[model samples]
Target: MSLKGKVALVTGSSRGIGKVIALKLAEEGAKLVINYPVADEAESAQQVVEEIEDLGAEAIALQADVTAMEEVKGMVKEVKQEFDTIDILVNNAGITRDTLLLRMKEEDWDAVLDVNLKGAFNVTKAISRIMMKQRSGRIINISSVVGLMGNAGQSNYAASKAGLIGFTKSVAKELAPRGVTANAIAPGFIETAMTDQLSDKVVEQMLSVIPANSFGQPEDVADTALFLASEGAKYITGEVIRVDGGMTM
Candidate 1:
């Protein structure tokens, strides 16, 4: 297994892309720390943990709101107690408050920025310290193609994701010397709970523009993430890989 004996903490991994990432990493033999913001959703987190255990790997679910610094700290503390160190950190917790600029509320903007951008900052800050000490780690931030190409009615979401790209680059530069790598995955139109809300006509319109002529799956993003976290990608950092199937090209 490529990740045998490694520990990975994936934030907001209760479902969707995050869940897939966690499972994929576990399949590669990484011990898993699954985090969820919603305390009531322990069952969702537990399901992932059970699956990992069934694969003969260790797993644990942690409840922490990534937007809350205190909660992030607590989550890190729990992971440290169980695993001692984190080799991979996936900042996958994000939320979108989509609306046109004219109708977007201050709260909407703040909420999106806080959860999508600041949440990554908080969790990465907490975990990078241990990684820097170990002199090795992989940090992958989940971004979106909309952050690169921009999209109507999603100004706040786009800004938060774009901000992640800049933040990922800066963090990568700062941590490179310590053997820590930070990168971003900008997914185009991945078929997830987020995209399920779009009508079939809307999806058809999107597919017309995408060269691949299909929506990306969560596993597609997870596969890219697994490669980035592997030794093969050790030298790669501060890069935003578009898993958009040529849509951004």
Candidate 2:
């Protein structure tokens, strides 16, 4: 888990699971680049950077809307200017708009796909070049259990995440020759702001189906990302590792 001298970039790291992933990597000695979507989130992003610095690691926050290619490129250019190389990339920016398939608006589906799937593509495409030149890097995409098992009223979200799995596998194969690896992490029922919005009955129902009988914390997913980025996982690639407490099993 030693990531000393590595420069890791995590998207949507202003808060939630992404923030935790950035912190976990920083704890292992990686210099961090935190990406948030907008100016409104600048404060939160700075806070994450400061926290990483507090851990005695270097960190900087950059703004970029993952759905936009130019912004993604600019963001990567800034990182290259400051760090010279990127050793890791975690695509953790995703959004969900739940609704029955019949009622799911086209905008919702497009929005989810734009951020969850295409965002991964935009950032990974830009960063893979750097990794290829360096001949080493790690890419971890944050997916969800729903992407694997399907969830009612969340067709859009499920589709985007499932697309990410396919993207990760293809990227893995494409980059393997250059010493870069790509993998997906499917998390389940994590107690985040998103899950907190679910009703008590919904939570209870989720717990009933989960073998752990309790929701996972963001750190659980963060630890999994840490493992995939570590030297121990050099042989692992193009795989979707579930951090879901046996929910899909």
Per-residue error (Å), model 2, residue 2: 0.9
TM-score of each: 0.98, 0.99
**Residue-wise lDDT of candidate 1 within 1-249, one digit each (tens)?**
489999999999989999999999999999999999987889999999999999999999999999999999999999999998899999999887778899999999999999999999999999999999999999999999988978998999999999999999999999999999999999999998999888788888999999988889999999999999999999999999999999989
Give the Å shift of residue 239 in candidate 2. 1.0
RMSD of model 2, in Å? 0.7
| Cα misplacement distance, residue 107 of candidate 2 (Å) | 0.6
Alpha-carbon local distance difference test for all models: 0.95, 0.95
Tens digit of lDDT per residue, candidate 2, span 181-208? 9999999999888787788998888999
Estimate the TM-score for candidate 1.
Answer: 0.98
Each prediction's total of clashing residue pairs, residues at least 3 apart in sequence or on different chains, is: 0, 0
Relative to the unseen true structure, what is the C-alpha lDDT of residue 38 in candidate 2, on a scale of 0 to 100?
96
